[model samples]
Every structure is written in C-alpha cells, then in structure tokens.
Target: MKYQDSLQQASDKAAQVKLFLQRTNLAAHPINYAVSYEYISGYNSELCHIIEHKLLAKAPLDDFVMAELYIRFLAPANPQQEQLLQEASSMVSRMAAYSDVAAEQLDNYIQQLDSSMLQIKNLGADTPLLNIVNQLQHSTTEFRLSQQQMQQQLLLANQQSHQLRHELEQLKQQRLLDPLTGLYNRLAMQNQLDIWFSEQPGRRIAAIAVDLDHFSRFNLEYGNTIGDVILSKVARKVSSYVQNSGLPVRSGGEEFLILLPDVDLRSASEIAEQVRRGVEKLRFVSSRTKKTLPKVTISLGVSLYQQTENWYQFLGRTAEVLLLAKQRGRNQVANETMLAT
Candidate 1:
C-alpha cells in the first residue's frame, strides 16, 4: 500500500520501481501484460511476490522482479501479442534504454517489435487498446497517461454512436411512411410484402384492385381540391373495413390495392361488396350541396392466388379482371378468377 501510494505520486521511473515492489502481489492477479512478456520470454510472478511480500519469505529471496522487468523490456521475440506489443514495447524500451547495461540491447528489441507489426494491420483498432496509444500521443513526457486518454476517447465514441443511431432511425421513418395519408408508402408496402412472403404465406391471400368509376370527371368538374377531399374520404372508408384484412395501399390516383390474407375468393368478394355498399350508401357532399349530394360508387376486381401463383402475377390478373368489372358496370364486385397460368 505504501509503495502503491509512492508510485502514484512518483515519476514514471519511480512508478516502474514501485511496480517491482508490488511484483509478488502481481502474481496473485492475472498478468494483463504477462502474455506479451511471455512471448518474449519473461514472467516475474514469484519475483513480484518477493518484492511485495519480502517480509513473509523463508530464506534469502531472489529478486526476479527487476530481472523479469528487464527481460520484459529487452526480450526480442513476440509473435502472438500484437495489440499492446508496440506500446508495451515502447514503455519497456523507455525503461530499459535508460539502464546503462541494456541501452544497446533495447534498440534490437524495438527493431524486432517493429518488424512484427509489418505482417499485421492495425489490430489496435479492434481492442480498446487506444488508451496506451492516446497516452503517448497526448501525454506529457513524464507521466503515463494511456488510461486517461482511453476514457476521453470512449465517451466521445459513445456520443457519436448515439447521434448516428438517432439520425438513422429518422431516415428510416421517412423512407417507410407515406407523408400525405400517414400510411405506409409504396416502398414500405413492397418491403413488408416481401417479408410476409418470406414468412408463412398469408393463410389465404387475396388481392383486390379498385378504380373509382367516372373518377376523371370528378377531378375535371369538381377541381383537384374537391377531388382531393373525395379521395381522402374514400381512403378512410376503405381502411375502416380492414379489421384483420391485409393493408390497403393507394396504388395510384383513383386506384387502390388491397391485400387480404387468409381470405379466399368468396370471402374477398363479400368484403369488396361491403366496401361497395358502404361507398354507395354514403352521401358525398360536393359542389355546394345544401342537400346531401350523390353517393359515390366503385368497381372492384378480386383475384385469389392458386398454389403456383406469385404476388406479382396475382396483382396483375386482379387489375385485368377489375377492368372487366368496370365494363359490366362501375358499381359491382367481380368474382375471383384463376390467373391464366
């Protein structure tokens, strides 16, 4: 404890000597740095104990701490320990080069350490070993400041990561949401459809294509503003029917695509009929109507997937059949038809 206190207040050399004083204490704790020292042939556990626990030893104790410390700084071969090799080597070299006896040998150790780095790319980027490097980069000549630099870098990295994640979440919201109706836009629709397709196939998948009969005249006569009102009403009314039904997407102006999972042709037709009846019965207020204006009506084309059909082909066939429903009359639901192969 006294030696640790002295080392805490002392210079790097004094701290290093204090480290030797606590050598045997180090043996009790796993050597965080021992693996690297072992690569170059050095372990000062018992010697460390002798220095720290000298009062407890039996006979004349051998001081392996200074010797192993010297070996740690001076040994030439280290292949496995790459992350701390440079900093550990540099710190050890600093200690050894000051010693008159090891000054010439320290140069050879550094040369070998430098050569080892050539085969390895920046491995330090992976571990939190930046503390040691940052210490050297920002440290005063006298103090070992690796741990301090590590703390500053850690906080900065965490803050940057949080900001980046927030930005990414916002971008994802923009990409996945429809700005006008607050529904999922087309891109998001396709993404979800793909995910659904990959998972359990929709128990009963039905695609219905709907077109507003005489919709063009509404835009032309009522003006785009009134037409927008009518469209919003239509979207809301259709969405209401989808309790557990698949999503309803605005495929295009005056047209919508409804995906109903686990619903077959007969059931899908019933749902479409419900939508038609709902729209037919509602009084649409348009063009200065003190009285309730004319009710809007829509034609729907429903298509059910056969075991072999994909969503793309199913949707295409549904649209074609929907055109047929328009030809018969604008206000009716067409029955499900098999996709022509």
Candidate 2:
C-alpha cells in the first residue's frame, strides 16, 4: 500500500506541473516544469506563493525570471559552507593567540640568557664559576627545547590556517557560481569588477551583453529538457570565445554577461561577434529521439566602461545596446559606436 501511495503521489505531482505549465503558458522545460511541480507539491511555500501571485497578474514566465526564482527559493543551502566559515574563524582566533604567547615566551627566554651571561661575569674563577657555566648550559638546553616545541606548534598552526583559508575560498567560489550553467553569477561579477577597479584604475573595461534569440519559443516547441541542453551548450560556446581575456557570467535566463578588461569598444565588439558566430554554429541533437534541433542564435550588445560612470550605469548602457540589437533584428552585434550615431 505504501509503494502504491508513493507512485500515486508522483503521478499527482506530474499532473500538477503539466496543469501549471498550461495555465501560465510556461514552457514545459525541465527547470520550469520542476519548479512548477515543486510549487504544487508545497515543497517551497514561498516560491509557490510568489509564482501564484505573478501568474494571477499575467506575468511572463521568461527563462531569466524563472531562473531567478529557482535560485532564490529552491536552491538548497550548503551546510558545509557554514561549517567551514565557523572553522576558519576559530582557526584565525587560535593563531592570533598562539602568536602572542610565542612572542612572550621568546622574550622570557631572552631575559634568562642575559641574566645567566651576567652571572658568569660576576662569578669567581673556580668551582662557582664552573657551576655557573654548567647552570647556563642547562638553561640554554631547556630554551632550545622550548623553541623547538613552539616552532612545531607554529608550523602546525600555519598548515591548519592555510587549509582552512583554501576551503573557505572554495566555498566562496561555489557560492558565486550559477547552479545551472556553471558560470559565474552576478555576485562574482560585482567582486571581479571591484577587484579590477582597485588594481587598475585606468584600465579599460568592456562588456558584452548576450541574449538568446527566440529562446522562449524554442522551449515551447522542444520542451525544457532540450532547452536546458541548448542553454548549457550556448553558455559553453560563449565562454570559449572569451576564455583567455575575459569573464563569462550567466547574468540571467537566456542572458549572459562577458566582461573584458583592458579592451576597448572595437575589440570587445569583435569578441562579441565571435561569440555570436560560435553560438550560431552549434548543433544540438536529441539523445532520446536522435533528431537534430533547430539552429540557435544570439544577439550581442557591446559597451565600454566610462571612468566617471558607476558600474550599474555601465551595465545599463550595455543592456540598452543589447535591446537595440534585438530591435534591429536578432543575431547581430550592436555597440556603443552605433549608439553614438
């Protein structure tokens, strides 16, 4: 009876996903479908409520918006991340305390050596002098042992600190990655921008904003599973184009951001064009049906960073250029030069 009940529940969940997809005119893609199924199953009440309200208001369930919802609500928290942070903090505190104690011990050892040397100068040239020399030797031996022990402790502490720092960095990198496309997310982009600005104040920064053409229609026709495969492929292709010189980020659903440092608008536009062509050349075949999928294309907008403008304004200008590309016709590159005219 339990097994039968579980099967029934699965069926019901699938039904609900289908119903939601139909009611909202959302693509029956895996990500979208899974989100819908989870909402109907009451797995994430917050996501369900937000989606319900959006649907009631007749909002478009575009890939970008849906991806945001999935990430914000459905992505599971990494317990390991929290544990690593706590361990790293503890290690830092312990190391600081250890350094203080080591410094104090070294000072005491130095004072003992100095006092012993003075006693040697004041002692007579007989048995008392010899005894003083012997006592000094013993003191030196003890000090050496203590120093060795402290050195060992310091080595151990250093190793632990290095390991914890590395782990924390890994966690931080993981946190800044988009789960779906294996690309850096917006948070990482912000960090990278900050680093660039701090390190090279006058360095030229360029942005290429890319949007997949007719992506929603593709999802509607081929379903989301195929759409996901295409999205990953396109992301990889775009990354390949700028792998050596820039950073590729999954900026939103069906959208990507490529940041090029030390590149001007012309160079950036060329790179964007290369990415556009690369994506156009990609061919996806369904593993299940062994059929070729439709051709995919991307529109790109290129903009150079202005020294006086903030990062948001820089990105906003790039987005505007991208919108112009889409308006002019899809699968083209639009740059700030065109905007100037």
Candidate 3:
C-alpha cells in the first residue's frame, strides 16, 4: 500500500520531484527527495496541502523543512520503542515457558508418587503395614492436588504479568502527549529534537513560537475554567496548520512551539502567519451564559536553526523574536529577518 507507482509512473514522479526540488532550492537528499516525491505523486493529501500553501505564498523549502515533512508523513516508527516492546514480550514468553516447565516437573513428581503407592501396596501383608499404605496414598494424593493448584496459579500470574507490561508500555507512550490539547508535550519535543540531531548533526530546524495575544487579560476577565477552554480551542487551530509537517508542542501553560525541520525562515514565518490567522478566526461563547466572548488572537515568532549555536540558544533566539512580535503589537508574526530590520 505504501507504493503503487510502476516503473514508468515511478520515473515520471521522480522527474517531477526533481523539478520541484530545483524550483524550491531544496537539496536532493533522500529525505528531501522522498518528501518531494510524495507531494508530487499526490498520494499524501495533507502533505500536498501544506506544500501547496507554501508554494502559493512563494515560500522557499529548505532541507530542514523537507526533513520535517519526511518525518511527519514518511518516517518509520521509532525502532527503539518497538525494540523495547519486543524485548518485554519476549521476556514474558520466557517466563511463561518456565511456568510450563514447572508444571511438567510437578506432573512427573505425581507420576513417581503413583508408582511408589503401587509398590507399597504390593509389599504390605500385615494390618499395620496396610494402614501405613492407605495413609501414604492419601498424603500423596493431597500433595499432587496442591502441586496442580500451585501450577495453575503460576500460569495465571504469568498471564497477568504480560498484561501489566503491555499496559505500562501504553502508559509510557501517553506520557509524551499533552492531555489537554492532544499535542506532544515538552518532553516529547525534546526527545524528537535529540533524535534528529543525533542522526544528522547538520539537520536544519525552524521553530515557531506561539503565544495567545492578551491571554492573561482574557483569563482575568473570564474565569480560569473559561480560559482553559479557549486555550484548548486555540491549540487545536494552531496544530491544524502543522498536521503532518511539523511537531506541534504544548511547551507549557498558554505557550506552544511548532518545529519544522528542513524549512527556511521565510516559510516558517508564513506558516506562523497561517497559525495566527487561524487562531484569530476561532470564536468562543460561554456555554452556560449563552454569551459570546471576545475574539481570540495569537502572536508568533519564527527562527531557523543555526549551526553556530546550540539548541537552547536557537530557542532563545526564537523567544526573542516572539518578544519582538509582542512588543510591536500583538496578533502579528515576527521572525529573525524582522529583528535585523
């Protein structure tokens, strides 16, 4: 299902992807080429939409942005996580096998008792000897029953352990996501970035720092409960723009960061503008009072990663850009270029 293009069709798609890369000034790296190929093939509608928007606005795509698109739409699932699950499952299987071996050993012991009982009955002739054989048989039978019961309990314990391990794996996965907005949390964002850098040291990354305009005032005007609703709504709107091209993160309270890999500063700013506009369009009303609330807007700042600086420094620069947007006027998108201006 992943690939349906035949020889001729695949060649044609490859040609178009080459053209797209040339037009957009993107390098023909494997990740970049694959993303372009997907966009040109039109198999991925969401990928096409995001790239089309950038094209319409004449925003250039770079290696960083292309890398991000590849990751969002085409990258394989995390091997480390998969390996962990596989290892855990394997361990449970081994434990279950051990339980089976224990059960088999108990069965062998029961058989031995049966053989001994028959031998004792044959040897007995006196009344006292016969009584001893009866007592021995009863004790052997009770011991056999107890061993079977213990074996059953052991099997049950192994099954429960397997189930518990699976649940723990699920919980570990959920921890990376924000419960409020259904977006990745800060920890997930960091882990993703770390992976990106570890795999490719020169990987380009662009960050869009987003903050709701006059959010504190809005929260003060309405209750925190109402503010939370608005925040969640805004998060949805912002994340929509980044569906498959970037990591939409709920960094902290009332703050979000959209990270696009293989994207240029201009393209990132454009995406940030789209997010700002989208949030501006969301209208909120109090469900209890049936009264409409004031329109919500967001301000954003965009920054491209620098090879000369560390990630923290890059984010700090992004935060600075966001501060500039806030200072100039809320509800606008600012970028590193504007900082120079």
Candidate 4:
C-alpha cells in the first residue's frame, strides 16, 4: 500500500525483488521482499545506503540482518521506544565523556604515584615502606585494568548510541513524509521553506499548487480503496517532475504543492504544465475489475515569491491562482500573470 507505482512499474519491481532475493540467497519471505522492494525502488535512502555499504564490504545479508533492517527502517514507529532510545543515547554519551575524563585523571595519578615511589626508593626507604608502596602500586594497577575494561565497554556503548541516534533521525524523517505518496508532508514543506528563507534573505521561490479535478466525485464512484490507488499513482506522477531541485508536498488530501527556489514564474508554470500533461497521459486500470478507469487530470496555479509578502501570503496567492484555473476549467496550468487578465 505504501507503493505508488503503476501496474507495470510494480510488476518490474517485483521482478527485481525476486532477482535480489535469489542473488543474496535470502528466502522470499515477506520481510525480505519488503526490504528489497523498498531498496530497489530507491525511495528509502537510508536503507539503500546501509545495504550498499554491506554489499561493498561483502557482508552476509542473512535473515537476521534483513529483519533488523526492516524493523529499523520500515516498521511502524513506537513513540515510547523512540523516547527511550533518545534517553539512552544521551545517557551513554554523557557516561562516555565522564569515563574519558576519569581515564585521563587516573593516568595522571599513576604517573605521580610512580614518581613518588622512585623518590621513596632513592631516599633509603625501609622494607615495610617499600612493601606498602608496592601494594599501593599493585592496587593502582588493578584499578587501572578495571578502568580500561570499563572504557572498552563504554566505547562499544557509545558506538551503539550513535547508531541508535542515526536510526532515530531516520525515523523522524520518515514521519515527515506522506506514507502513501512518499512526498513531503505539509510540516516538512513548512520546515524546508523556513530553512530556505533563512539561508537566503529575499530569495525568489515559486509555488505550484496542483489539485486533482473532481476527486471527491471520483472517490464516490470508485470507492476509497480504488481512489487511494489512483491518488498514490497520481502523487507519484506529480512528484516525478520536481526531482532534486524542488520540494513536492502532499498539501491536502488530493492537492500537492511544489516549491521551487530561485525559479522564475515562467519556468515554474512550464514545469506545472509538464506535470499536468504527464499526469494526463497516465493510464489506470482497476486490477479487480479488469476495466480501465477514467483518466486523471490536474489543475495547477503557479506564483513567484513577493519580497513584501511572507510565505503564507505567497502560498495563499498561489492557491487563489489555482482556484482561478479550476474556475476557468480543469486540466490546465494557470500562472499569476493571468490573474490580472
């Protein structure tokens, strides 16, 4: 259900998933299939990076390893577990720092003790005194050994803490994305916009508000299940145009907003037009009924950032332009320039 690929695309991924399972000699279990499918889809960057590193190192991709990856990357999040991991990571980091400082102080103490013992030996110390010094030295050595063992344990725990922190960060990112579309959700869009504004003052940004035409009607006719499939596919199609330079966001149930920085109004409108046509060309057929569904179309409104207005105002203006597009008729791109006309 998380997949947004068309029938052919899903079929192709299934083939690739099978090949991956065969090559790795992993059983075609559901967990293994899910991991491989997501990896091959290239949607989960964190999973792909870890798997690629393991492959490079010639590490075994056994069932345990695959299960761990699935749980870490794909499994549903547990808020309590997340909080516990965060607390554990912080505690381990603090303990590691304390141990390091303690180890340094212990080394200095050992050096001072050695110098005192030498001075005592040079100053004609008696056998009883020498024996006491030897005993102290022996105790110190034992303490140092224990400290070293603790340091080793702390070092391993520190490494594990770092891993947990990285996984926690990945989980946070996953939450920012729409589970069905894999596009940035509104929260993520707001965060990215804030970052962009802070990074470059008075920078030009373009927003394209894309709305599916009569989606509620479609949902009513096809039922929610089929509508979801269609929405996922259309969301994927809408995102394909943005690529690396822009943020594609699932702003509403059937609305998407693409944010492009440093882009002019004309270019953004053109991109919107391309998205419109590309989505128009997508063909969807109901797998259960074996009947072709109606073609899906989108209406988009494009606007550029205004130096005098805040981001919300800019987005509002863009949405208004999109509404104008819908008023004129659906399945088209409308830009801010047309607002005056």
Top TM-score model:
4
Task: Return the TM-score for candidate 2, rounded to 2 decimals.
Answer: 0.59
Candidate 3 per-residue lDDT, tens place, 1-341, comes to 68888999999988898888888887888898888888888888978987776665444456645755676668787546667777877787788788878988888988987898788778757889878878988998799789978988988977887787778677777767778788887568878989888989999889999988888899998989999999888888888898575899986567889999889888888889888888887888899999999998888999999998666567767778888999998899999988988
**Over 4 Å off, model 4:** 1-152
Query: Which candidate leads in lDDT?
Result: 4
List the RMSD of every prediction in angstroms.
35.4, 8.6, 17.5, 17.9
lDDT by residue for model 1 (1-341), tens = 21243433445544454464355343322242332233222244633443333333221122233333333333444223333444554554444334433433544554554554433336645344555544543433222244345444554654555555555556556645544444445556666677766787645678777778898887887688877778778877887887654887776657777788778788888989999888777777655756554567899999886657554455656777787788787799886553342
| lDDT scores of the candidates, listed in order | 0.59, 0.80, 0.82, 0.84
Please estimate how well model 1 matches the true structure, expressed as its whole-model Cα lDDT: 0.59
Better of 3 and 4 by TM-score: 4
lDDT at residue 100 of model 3 (Cα atoms)? 79
Worst 10 residues of 4 by lDDT: 56-65
lDDT of 4 by residue, 105-156 (tens): 8778878888887798889889999899889889878977887787687667
By lDDT, the candidates rank as 4, 3, 2, 1
The deviation in Å at residue 127 for candidate 1 is: 46
Q: Per model, state how many residue pairs clash.
A: 4, 2, 7, 0
| Between candidates 1 and 3, the TM-score winner | 3
TM-score to true structure, per model: 0.48, 0.59, 0.56, 0.60
Q: How far is candidate 4 from the true structure (C-alpha RMSD, Å)?
A: 17.9
